[model samples]
Each structure stands twice: as structure tokens, then as C-alpha cells.
Target: MKNITFADAQNLKNPIFIDIRSPREYAEDHIEGAINLPLFSDQEREIIGKIYKYEGVSQAKLAGLNFLSPKLPRLVKEILAYKEKGDIVVYCWRGGLRSLVFTEILRLVDIYVYRLEGGYKSYRQEVVRFFETAKTLFPVVLYGMTGVGKTLILKKLAEKGLPVLNLEQLASHRGSVFGHLGLLPQPSQKRFESMLYDVLKELKGFPFLVEGESRKIGKLFLPKELFQRMQEAPVILLELPEEQRIKNLLRDYQVDKIDIKYFLESLQSITVYLGRAKVESLSEDLKKGRFYEFTKTLLREYYDPLYKKSTAYLRNIKKVISGNDIDELVAGISEYWGEFTGRDLK
Candidate 1:
């Protein structure tokens, strides 16, 4: 069993990280791309903790061993299966007893594996440090009114092998009042930062593209340094006709397929802004399948006005790309970015 620093383990080709923490711990936050194979279940961990606190370390160790004895054979077999695919590196909360003992057991079976030196805690510290000191990033921010295809453009750019920091995807929210309507629950703040760090690391030293967003996205907040960098970076404004914008939004939101009751519930959030009477009218339109009218009313009365106010503070507008065709709009953005950065996209 060899002990490896997080940096060294990360450099290992085709490394499979096995997290030896409890399932609940892993669920809260763990290294990205890690597989969880716990040494104890959540309840067992609690039992061990109580023993350690009341009965002392010696008794706690005895209890832990008893619990682990029955699971040893199954655990070794599961790890071996992963070893066949790639190098297996194991870690616990702080590269402590659990990982140390597990690797020692594997050694007895002639299964050599690497142990993460400082565990998930170490990796998390690295993530926090990154956002604290990341200052040289060049972000080409995409700014546009709602339904102007900013997210779609980012997806297309990524498909073409360009660097893109997709904050919305990381947060699992679309960055709006209704952003969470059809999306999965947002990641925890720590997990969001960790995932963001992974992407930024991959795109280091490149001019990555990102969308213009407020400090907060759904329940998560962007790191202050990252938001500052985006604010100071060059901006590209996208435009689409009002009718086309409404159509794009309707498709994006899947208004026709979403539960009307839930949609009406989401509408309640904006009652103060749209007024109670207007929200009621929108609800009626939605019930009657008047999605076009519903979307148009929201965009013109709510989204567009808010967007106008948001952009008022942005002083840097390097280019504007507008078109009815998505492909053409992408081409226009790519062409301008290539000229501005003097880097060929093709």
C-alpha cells in the first residue's frame, strides 16, 4: 500500500478513486468521479462514534473490527473488480484510520493499491484555495435577454471543442425564478464549487466562454473571485426577434409538457412583480393551452424589463450577434471570438 498525495493521484492515468467514507458523507460531498464503498454504514458509524466517546478508543476499535469482519470478503471482491479496469486509489475523510486499515487488509490479499494522503478534506481545501487565488482567467461572457439562446450557444461551442464554464449546468438550475421548475435539485455549495474547480482546471490557460449571470444561481452562490473575473471580462450580447424568443422559451421550458399545477405554483413567486391580476390572467392562459400568449406576456412584461436593468451596469460590450438561425448565430459568435482572441476556432 503506497500513500499518494492528491496531486500525484490525480496525475495517475485512468485512476479509479474509491471513497471509503460513509454513504451519507459521500452524498453530502466527495471527490468528483469517486465510487463510494463505505467501511461502515451511517448507523454503524454513529455507534462507533458513541463507543469512542464513552467507551474510549480501544473499545471503539474492537467494535469497528467486529462490524468490518463480516464485510471484508465482499469489500475485497468489489475493489478487485474495479482494479481490473484501472489503478484504485482509496481515501477517507482525512486519509485517517479507515483508509489506512482498508489498504493494509488489501495488502494481505496481495492487492496493492494507493491511498490518498489527505483524503477528501485535502481535496476540498485545494478547491477552496483555487477559487481564492484564481485571477488570470480570461472569460468571454455571453450576455443576452432571456430566451436569446445563451445556453444553447454555450452547448454548441462545447460540442465544437471550445472551453466553456457552464455555471447553470453545474448548479442544476437555469438561473431564473422558474429555473428550478424542471431541473434536478441543485448541488450543495461545496459540491458546486468542487465541480466548478474541475472544469476550470481543465480549461486553464484558455479563453473559456461563460454566460452572464448574477452572483447567485438557484440556491448556490458563485465564488466572489469568479464573479469578479466575469464582470471585468469582455461581453458578447445576443439578440433574437420577440416572436422567436417566445418560441425558444416555450420549447426550453417545455411548458406544454410540464404539470400545470406546478407551473401555476411557480408563477406565484412573481406575483409581486407581475401583480396578482396579471398572474391570474397568465394562469388562465396556461390552463387553456395558450402557451404562446403566456410566454410572450412573461417575457415582455417581466424578463425583458429585468434584463434591461441588469445590463445597465455592464460597461463592456465587445460585439453583438443576432440571427433567426441558430447555426448562423453560432457562426457569428465563433467568428468574432476568433478575431478578438486571434485564436482559430476551426
Candidate 2:
């Protein structure tokens, strides 16, 4: 099998990366855009590993070969399906037996197979390294307390001919415990970076506004470089009155779907601070169609206090813009962005 580097692979508009590892491993992490054409299923790999340890290499090889033999035609068909589109590169956990065997199998069919030199492990290291150094990308930060419509506002700014980098949208997550309330499952970190890079590639070299976020969003962590950049970036705070904020949050949260059980489950994320009885009382209120009371109680008892602490810490770097009335938040965001771009507000 021929070899290729991660840098070269990434530069390809499309490259078929066959990750011949167990599905479990792929689920944990894999190179973005990789297709899992495993040489062994999860359970089979476990059995093979045990056999190799107790009965030695020869016994393990025979068992693996036997398992792969029946699946050979199936594997070839799978590779051809993806291969019909682009150059195919395949690898396993390491530059080890699994991928090598599969590469040879494909080569016999006259397909030029490129094996990743150090395998998925090395690819992961490269991704981590890139993330560590990536913050040099120059990000302008977007900041706001919970439910100020910052996310929706970001979308509006992008629509109005402003350059914006929407990290939260890219991550398929909103950057909070309740962030996943109505969204699809988040992409793996590898996919997140791939999406981030793709977005970054679209903008000219200049300051771009991004929502303020911690290093990790849901199960994915921002690469070290981008995370540090976000932490140090200039912040633009979007503010709204408490009443408007609550109303906007009600729409954002979709109160019609906020059943008591789900509400309690969300509150459970903060059980250490809000005791169980308090949570239960709030839940009871929601069960009786008292959403306003539940939301008010949550804000007074939990969310508002936490937001104050967070805002206090961010005060120096934050540029606060308050009283963004519901009808005006979008236009306000656009005007603010226009000011940054040196354009008269339209």
C-alpha cells in the first residue's frame, strides 16, 4: 500500500479515509470524514485480542484471516461504493495489521490504496496539535447572558453582509446544559474542527465575531488554539430587560414543549445548588401550567445568580449593550456590526 500524510489528506476536496477499527473506537474519535470499514467488529476484535495474548500471534492471525475471508467481498463492495467518488486512503488504530491487510485486498482489485503512515492515533495527535495552535485565527467575541437571543442575533448579523464565525452553530450545540434542548446530536470533535475550518476558510483575514464559549461544548472540546483565542477576544455583550429576556427565552426554550418531567430533568443538572425540594416545587408549578412561575423561580433561585457571577468575571473585557427590545434585537445587532465595519446604520 502507498502512504500519505494527514496534511495532504486534509487538503483534498474529498478523500476516502477508511478507518478499519472497531465501531466503538470510531465512535470515541476518528478522523473527520472517515468511513469505518472495520476489519473486525467490536466483539470479534475483543476475541481476537484475547486469542493473540493467550495463544500467540499465529493463532490470532489464523482466526482473523478466517473472519475476514467471508467478509472480503462485502468489504470490497463497500470500498468501491465510496471509492467511486475519490482517492481512497485507509488506516487502523496504528500502521498495523488490520489496515495493511485491507489495503492489500483492495490493491488486488486494481484500486490504488493509500495507507495513513502512523494511523488514526497519529491523525488524532495532529488534530490536537492544530487545535493547540489554532487560536491565532483572530476571533471577535460575542457575549450575553442566557436567553438574550445572542445565537439568533448572530445568524441575523451574518445574513446582513457581516463576517461572522458562529462557533455554537458549527458545533451543533448552544453551549449550555439546556443547549441540546431541541438540536440534533453534536458532531464529533473531528467533525467540529472540520466544520470550523471550512467556515474560517470562507472569511477574509479580519476580525470575526464568535459567541463566547468554554473550551468544551457538550461532548466536544475546542482545539487549544481556538479556545485560548475565544478567552482573550474582545467581547460584545447583547443585553435585554429581564422581562423581555424571559419572554425571548420562553420562545427560545419553546415553553409549549417544556413538560414538567423534562423541566425537572434539566434542573437536575444543578441539583447541588438548588435543593431537591425546591426543584420539586418548581416542577409542581410547571405541572399546573405555571411556566412563568417556574421560570421566575429558576431565574431568581438559580440562573440569575450564576449569570451575575459569570458577568462579573467578564466585566472588564465585556462591552455591554442593554435593553434590546424583542422587535429590535436583530436590527440592533446589525447596526452594532455595521458600526464595527465602519458603515452607517441603515
Candidate 3:
């Protein structure tokens, strides 16, 4: 079994990362592309832990062997399938007995593989270090009121091969009160950072387009250094007519497909700002299927006021592009970026 650092493993050509940890651990976070092939199930790992705590390390080792022995053939077969695709690299929570034993078993079967040194923990440390020290990132932050197509425009710019760091996508939250609506559960904070690191590492030392966001996106917070940089970076404010803004939000949120009970609950969350009476009225409008009116009232009475107040401190406005056409807006942004940086943003 060869030991490899996470950095070296990443450099491997088409490496297939096999996570040899429990399913629960892998579910929380693992190497981004790693597949989970558990050495023991979650309950089995817990059982071994109890043995180690009460019956000593020897008992725990015996228990672990009993749990793993039956699964070896299947696990090896699954890993061998992946090996045909690329070089196999295995990891557990740490470079501990699980990975070591798994790699040894593979060796016995003549299936050589690299074991990740210090496993997931080491990779996580690298992610933390990257966020703390990365200083050369040039962010062209897209600033706009809600429903002005900031995320949509960033996606378009990315399709055109411009570097784009989509924070919302990484966080799995839209950076708003309703950001979690119709989306999967947000990843753990560590998982979010891992995803963010994967994107930022590639865009290091280059200007990347990202939607402007507050420090927190749903339950996840942006890295302190990165958020500070965004606050200080040049901004391009996007605008759309109020009617179009409402339409855009309606389509984006898919109000027709939303659960009414959940929608009402989300509306109540901002009652302190919108007042109980206004929220009740909005909820009624939603229940009545007056989506356009519900959206318009929320924008004018809640979102717009908040957006104006939050952006009041930003004095570094580089340009303001207004339109309902996505393609036109993208072209306008590309033109401004070229003019501002004196380099084509193709």
C-alpha cells in the first residue's frame, strides 16, 4: 500500500477516490469525488468503538475484523471495478486502521492502490489553509436587487468560458430567507467549504465573476477573507423593470409548485420586518394564487427596502446594466469587464 498526500492524489490522472469510512461519515463530507465503500457500517463502527472503550483495543480489533471479513470480497470487487476506470486511492476519517487494512487486503489480491495520508482530515486542513491565505483572487462581484438575474447572468458568463465562482451553488442556498425553498438540504459547513475550495483553487490568481452575497448564505457562512474581498471589489449592478423582476422571481421560485403550508411558514419568518398584518395579507394572496401580486408586494415592501439599505454603504459601483434580456445583459457585463480591466472577458 503506497501512502499519498491529498495534494499528490489530486494530481493523479483520473484518480478514483474510494472512501473507506462509514456511510454516515461519508455522507457528512468526504473528498468531493470520492465514492463510499464502507469498511464497517455506522452501527458496526459504533459497536467497535464501544468495545475499544470497555473491552480494550484488542477486543475492538477483533470486533472490527469480524464485521469486515464478510464484506471483503464484495468490497474488493466494487473497488476493482473502479480501478479499471482510474488509479484507486482510498481514505478513511484519518490514515488509520480501516484504510491500512483495506489497502493490505487489496494488496493480497494483487490490487495495488494509494492510501490518502491523514485521510479526509488532511484535505480539510488544506481547504482551511487555502481560504485563509489566498490573496491574489480578483473578484468582479455582480450586485443587484433580488430577481435582477445576477445568478442567471453569472451562469451565462461561465458558459462563455469566463471564470465564475457560484457561491449559491456551492452553498446550496440562494443567500436569502427563501433561499432553501425547493432545494435539497444544505450540506454541512465543512462540506460547503470543501465545495467552495474546489472552485476557488482553480480560479486562484484570476478574475472570477460571482454574485454579491452577504456573509451568510442560509446556514453557511462565507470565508472571512473572501467576503471582505467581495465587499472591497468592483461591482456591476444589474437592474430589471419591476414587472419583469416579479415575473423572473415567480419563474425562479416556482410558486405554483411550492407547498402552500411551507410558503406560509417562510413568510412568517420575516414578520418582524414585514409586520404580522402584511404577512397575513401576503399569505392570503399566496393561498388565493395571486402569485404576481404576492411577489410584487414582497419585492416593494420587503426585499427592495432591505436591498437598498444593505447596499447603501457600497461606493465602488463600477457600472449599472439594466435589461430583461439575459443574453443582452451578459454581453453588457462582458463589455464592461473588458473596459474596466483592459482585458477581454471572453
Of models 1 and 2, which has the larger TM-score? Answer: 1
Q: What's the residue-level lDDT of 215 in candidate 3?
A: 89
**TM-score (all chains, Cα) for each model:** 0.94, 0.82, 0.95
Rank list by lDDT: 1, 3, 2
Candidate 2 per-residue lDDT, tens place, 1-346, comes to: 6888877876777888888899988876777668888888899999999999999999999999988899998988888888889878898988888888889878888877789988987886775665566644667676766777777777877887777887778777777667677778897767677667657655644667787777888888887777776777667777777777787777877767845466668778877888888977877887788877777777777877877777532743535676657447666656666566563211
lDDT of candidate 1 over 248-296, digit per residue (tens): 8888889888898888988999999999999999999999999999999
- Candidate 2: misplaced stretches above 4 Å? 155-206, 215-225, 268-280, 312-327, 335-346
> Model 3 off-target regions past 4 Å?
341-346
Which structure among the candidates has the greatest lDDT?
A: 1
lDDT of each: 0.89, 0.76, 0.87
Give me the displacement of residue 105 in model 3, in angstroms: 1.5
Q: What is the Å distance of residue 243 in model 2 from its true position?
A: 3.1
**lDDT (Cα, tens digit) per residue for candidate 3, span 107-211:** 998999999999889988998898888576678888888888777788889888888998887787777788889888899988888888888888757788899
